[model samples]
Target: MPATSTNTCRNNAVTKVLELEGLTKSYGAVQALRGVSLHANEGEVLAICGDNGAGKSTLIKVISGAHAQTSGTLRLNGREVRWSSPHDALVHGVATIYQDLALAPQLSVWQNVFVGAEIRKTLFPGFSILDKKRMRAGAAEYLARLNQNIDDVERPVADFSGGQRQAIAIARALLWNASIVIMDEPTAALGVKETAKVLALIRHLKDTGVTVLLISHNMDDVVQVADRVVILKAGRVAAQGALEGISPATLAQTVMTGEWPQVQ
Candidate 1:
């Protein structure tokens, strides 16, 4: 049987990668999130689900360092942490891939992958140029690690499919050596095959010991990939548990009604 939601470091096999306690956020009079607490073990695919206005987006923003929480704490690998910015979060091994995937449509795949942290080739002292060759090879290597094949890393992102774009974004995260990846609606609006491709990429991340915080409304995708799920409602955690025996329909209903299905 799969394990339920619990803090790790109890066993070598279950070291936790992230933890939250009394996490709260507000926009002056608007409480976007309440004392939301959760933990994710290393390599675990933890699905975060909630209806519109359930604080899923706000919670992600806080976790990804886009916004600071009003109160409470965040811990990575059992060490308390506070993020100053999204780049700060990325530097600390947390990377967020939003619904847009944040790719430069006009840029080539390698360019998109190494957007912020570009490799530099020094021709002389105190001066360097973009190391296109190294970055291109590295980008291809990362995508290959995800089992995605792109014939040309120089091709503009605008020419690729939605799923392939996702791969490129993930490869960017890989470039950062991210330990935790937050994916927002990764398979949204994708064709079945494309969705499968994205899901496979997610699975590959998990298999490689990367903790994933997956925000998705598709219960089928959640059930197929998530080991555990947290359902939020009205800025608080409504229900949470392992997905061991639950069906996607039941999970969907739980998300809507804020109640876990009762055991017979």
Candidate 2:
């Protein structure tokens, strides 16, 4: 059965925030993804793990509106719709934080947080001014809420560490009221302490009732922060289940060999 056919592994009581059924994507002669399906519950951390060529990036692109699926159905909050672009997905409350982060290096923290979606106040008809004061304050509040160590919101993001930059990106997503946050390789290239901080931030998002879709190769991080996991092999789901019942070794084995072993 397809992964989306049944929400058996999911908590039936909670509503599914995002659902993809038989999602397939192809690039000319190259078929990047097959008939992949999955669902993410509201306020839960769902991890997607796979080997190097398992089409993980293609799947993420499909869901984030970076690429349209060749054949499949994507349902958001039980409604069927197609997003034209990443901005459309963001408008629908689906925010993706890619590895590059897309932050303007020279811009201040507050500026980066509210880059395209700037807050504004209208003083006259057809005229509005950017609410710099409110944006700065809001940015500071969001960062503080996440318990990040960035003391100054007016400083350029280029001056911050990798983990601090990740925290800011997350804050921007939450500031936009994103119901579902998709993070791709959030811990990549970071030191041990930095990775821990990002993991804690993910936990914080879950605690605040935000659904998170985490894509990472770090089995230890997945085991530590993910509530559930879906392993992909050759562009299809190989195994999926709650992390509490599966060990990190089992997850690693499933990714490497495309087999789900008995947990005992």
Candidate 3:
């Protein structure tokens, strides 16, 4: 079993966007997660940090509906939800941006952004056709709102920069009116400038009232973007608290050592 924290400050902000209570998952004799619990509030970015085999990926998969919890309660906006699959979670406005970005390299920018959920219209009352104009216009509108300027919405996303491609993926989630956005290693394999752009876009999402769950092994990235941090070890929460309540040194130590050594 992983550790738990009972020391919570009174003045902490309220407004829970996502919560996991007693979440557990097992495979044969090995337990992937043992009663792991965590939460992220609206307009806040929660960073889930842990080393390899820490069950970080497992937890996110459960919450994002990729995997079901063997035993636990999953709640969104104070209501318990039973998500059978990733699509089920998406129906509830939960969007996930995986490590690969999931963009079709061969597809055009607008096509990729509006791939699964494209806009269509009816022409001549009965015979309906896809609304290419509205989609192009809407995609352009969304990208522009994010301070991103892509010359051609019809251009293939493979031709865009890493930062621009990430922005497009995020814009797609926003277009769906997603309430909870989960990003896995968002800044991985990017240049310094590209990383900065991704961070700026994440802040933009928070400012727009989107709850963010950021999974990263990079402490500097977590400290820079996460409002709260949840450290997991051996499939259970080792420590969970506001970023302001803990120092980076303490956080690093807790993750690497898996022991909550009292701060000196």
Candidate 4:
């Protein structure tokens, strides 16, 4: 497949939802990130790909506020900001869905969706209780918006398939009104059908105006859904631009060798 140029992938007028400039992270004497920089445009799917030990995890940790960068600036919606913690980032409309999916197996789908942030009702001036009905309704609405049909939102997540669990996780993010959603290898361990569903859901997210930063080793998934690709090599950005005009083989080669292939 011919790759599309960056200019042709998306309109240049789209707002940049997240921006990182000269970002670096270090642990004692060992540096994990070396001045890596990139930007995710609004309503675009940006795939981050690299070989093992390429600092992909570290970069996302910094973006999610799990770790602070040693240097460099992070801009959200064009404004510089520092996050004190992951919750701080979430509060600012940034949400991360790790490979684990983070759904509680013992809890119902709606319960998992609003675990830490449940709705509440105050019957009196000083009394409040969990609003189970409202939470269930909200969860159902979000799931439906994602075109996910669950026979019962009250059912435990352990009974659901891998793809369904991922949908619930994404629904939770949407319920929080997240504008930027970061997914770490969402299709990992999923069967072909399940992976296809998740890929379609990711495309749905972009269509709904959500910016996605996807970190994955699956070139096929990235090529299928990503509007742009960022290749990281040993904690530094090797190559990045519009995915247009780039082939999966060329992308894999860039990940392994940290150099763009010379066109013949």
Candidate 5:
């Protein structure tokens, strides 16, 4: 088990976009989360780090509405909110981009971006058609927001690189006007170039005033993009603090030992 440290980070004067208080989840015989509490301030990148079985996935599942917590309160923008499903959470301005990107390989760029929430135009009183023109244009705009230039919006997603696929997933979040974006292992497997591109996309999201909850195992990646970090250990918050003076080596050490003596 890793050592525990106090939670000493502050949000300054920024607003808390998402707050989880005493959040817990349990199975018939196992408790996955034990009173986990954390907050993500508006327009900031908050990194979540932990070893395997540290409850990172469960925490993301609860926040992304894939599963409901056994007991806890979730506040979005200072108001209590509960999600019935992932789409429910998405429509309420929270979107999660998983490690796989959740993109259809056969679908085109615009189609993938507008997968669940496709735009349509009513041609008659009772009939509507897919609005490809508007959707394509909108998708292009979203991609542009991430500094990506995909000349063909009709290109298949499978043809793009790993980082480009991430951009497509993020564009979908932008289409929904998500106030908070949760990215899970955004840079898990990629070359140096692709990882850098993904990092740039995260910075772009923060620049656009979008709160990002980044869950990653790569300490260097986390250290580069995270404004603050929360380290979990065995279904509990072992430690959390700002990453201002923490190096990648220091952060990795803290994750392994759950101690941040000098970084604090």
Candidate 6:
């Protein structure tokens, strides 16, 4: 998904890489989203925390261009954009990793990394084939940059551990020069160690200057990586602010009740 929406951070430090204003989506008479807004800043991690049916998936779908907005502005770097398709969002450097991660179990790591956008070496005047050598080398370079220790880029994705597979998916996004990465329930079913590894990768992305919008119900992961928390309740923003400004207890309260505390 492309980083299509931006909301101002209550904290006063950075500029938003993406913004959404009055974003709405509907399915016939049923409204999935209504006038919701949020933002992800450059190099910052923004977490969207909400329970099931809180409109999180709809929000990501709209932003990713999997679903068109019924009304509102999708802004990247403050300019309103009307994304017509998911590829349009991808062309704008927004890459989304759904819970599925979109990896091919039967394909080699390098092949999956360059699946649609494979590099070609024109050996003759008009012929081109997949450049296995270039692809392998480039895949190794990217994996190494992520500090991953995969010994064989030729091996299938199913051979890699969960963490390594997640790393490969992330590296694929980076290979495409994605500036904003949206990850939905990235750590959903992983064991403790795998979840830790994915969390570390999230931190690594933040340190490497990529803005991240993480969607998860895990409060622990939310506080650990997110600089700010945007709680989407009943298709609207119920509470949003710097993480430091809100406590875990308060966040949990908001999740259960859909109301921000007074903090008096």
Candidate 6 wrongly placed segments (more than 4 Å): 1-13, 245-247, 262-264
lDDT of each: 0.90, 0.86, 0.83, 0.87, 0.88, 0.84
Q: 77-195, model 2: which lDDT tens digit per residue?
A: 89987889988887777889999998999999999988777889999999999999988888888788789757789999999999999999988887667878899999998999999
Screening candidate 6 with a backbone cut-off below 3 angstroms (N, C-alpha, C), the clashing residue pairs are: 1-96, 2-94, 5-18, 5-19, 5-20, 6-18, 6-19, 6-20, 7-38, 7-39
Model 3 per-residue lDDT tens digits across residues 46-165: 999999988988888999899888999999989999899987887687889998888998888888868777777877877888888878877887788778988689988889988998
Judging by lDDT, tell me the better candidate of 1 and 2.
1
For model 1, how does the per-residue alpha-carbon lDDT over 143-231 read when each residue is reduced to its tens digit?
A: 88888899799999999999999999998888888889999999997999999999998888887788899999999999999999999
TM-score versus the correct structure, for each prediction = 0.94, 0.92, 0.91, 0.93, 0.93, 0.92
Q: By descending TM-score, how would the candidates be arranged?
A: 1, 5, 4, 2, 6, 3
Question: How well does candidate 6 score on lDDT at residue 4?
Answer: 18
Clashing pairs in 2: none
Clashes of each: 0, 0, 0, 5, 0, 10
Model 1 local distance difference test score: 0.90
Off by over 4 Å in 5: 1-13
**Residue-level lDDT for 43 in candidate 5:** 85
Deviation of model 3 at 189, angstroms: 1.0
| Residue pair clashes in candidate 5 | none
Q: Is candidate 2 or candidate 5 better by lDDT?
A: 5
- Point to the candidate with the largest TM-score: 1
- Error in Å for residue 227 of model 3: 0.9
| Superposition error at 60 for model 2 (Å) | 0.8
- Residue-wise lDDT of candidate 5 within 163-250, one digit each (tens)? 9999999988887778889999988988999999999999888877789999999999999999999999888998899998788988
For candidate 4, the 10 contiguous residues with the lowest summed lDDT are 1-10
